[model samples]
Target: MRLLYSIVMLVLTFSASADISGRVVRVLDGDTVEILQASRERTRIRLAGIDAPEKNQPFGQRSRQFLTRLVAQRHVRISGDERDRYGRILGTVWLDGEDINAVMVRNGLAWAYRYRGKATEPQYAEPEAGARAVKSGLWADPAPVEPGLWRKMQKTPE
Candidate 1:
């Protein structure tokens, strides 16, 4: 079992290190996008380490629009190797050499993605703090809800 785990880890590491170049074909939401790779494959990527508002949530459409303005139809480099349960590639997107994930949070369009109430990536903390301090984008809302919490509320019985 340990050997199997090690092998899986190795494979994941290798894949994560492999960079894929593609052109953004669609922006599914603030944190999700579809890209057409040079190999002619369409890949769905979930921006790593950031969470944006849902389509129905406050600032959701705005978040998507912001991302669209940044990467729509532009060629980018994707650097991530893991696959989420939804079969989407979990990775960081780079456009014009800028890290889009960090940009989203820094601009207050998204939050540093958290797992179990803890931040999964530390690099986004400072950006989030700055955005919050200035009330930028989604932060302008006095009581903006995190997308995860919003999702739960949506599923709860009223």
Candidate 2:
């Protein structure tokens, strides 16, 4: 049993380290997408270091649309070192040399999600600050509800 556990752990480690490249097959939302590899396998990826609004939240549709317009059907490169609890690869996405994760934040389509005591890179931070300053997209609301808070509120009894 111990040997089996060790082997599983080793495989998981190696899998996480593998770099990924594929064409985007679907845009599930502003921060998630399905990529289809040349081998016909599909991998779900969650855009790292950012959180866009929930589908029902304000600016949600626009966020999805923005992402779809940017990368749907395009080949992308993913350099991720981790996966989220949901088994989605957590990574930075690049399309035509553009950082799609940062682009979403810069356009005010998403928020830089600071996790584990580390804030996102300046690639995400500077644009977010600029977007907030300009009142772009969701920031245009007098008070926009954060995606995290919005998710919690959705589960509470009204």
Q: Which candidate is the best by TM-score?
A: 1
Q: What's the TM for model 2?
A: 0.86
**Model 2: how far is 68 from its true place, Å?**
0.2
lDDT of 1 by residue, 1-158 (tens): 99999999999888767989899999999999999998899999999999999999999999999999999999999988889999999999998889999999999999999888677988988999999999999999999999989999899586
* lDDT digits (tens) for residues 82-139 of candidate 2: 8899999999999988889999999999998866545565567788889999999989
Candidates' C-alpha lDDT: 0.95, 0.91
Give candidate 2's error at residue 156 in angstroms: 2.8
lDDT computed for candidate 1:
0.95
Which regions of candidate 1 are displaced past 4 Å? 1-16, 156-158
Superposed by TM-score, candidate 1 places the C-alpha of residue 92 at a distance from the truth, in angstroms, of 0.5
Estimate the overall C-alpha local distance difference test score of candidate 2: 0.91
Model 1, position 155: C-alpha lDDT score = 100
Give the Å shift of residue 48 in candidate 1: 0.5
Count of clashes, each model = 1, 0
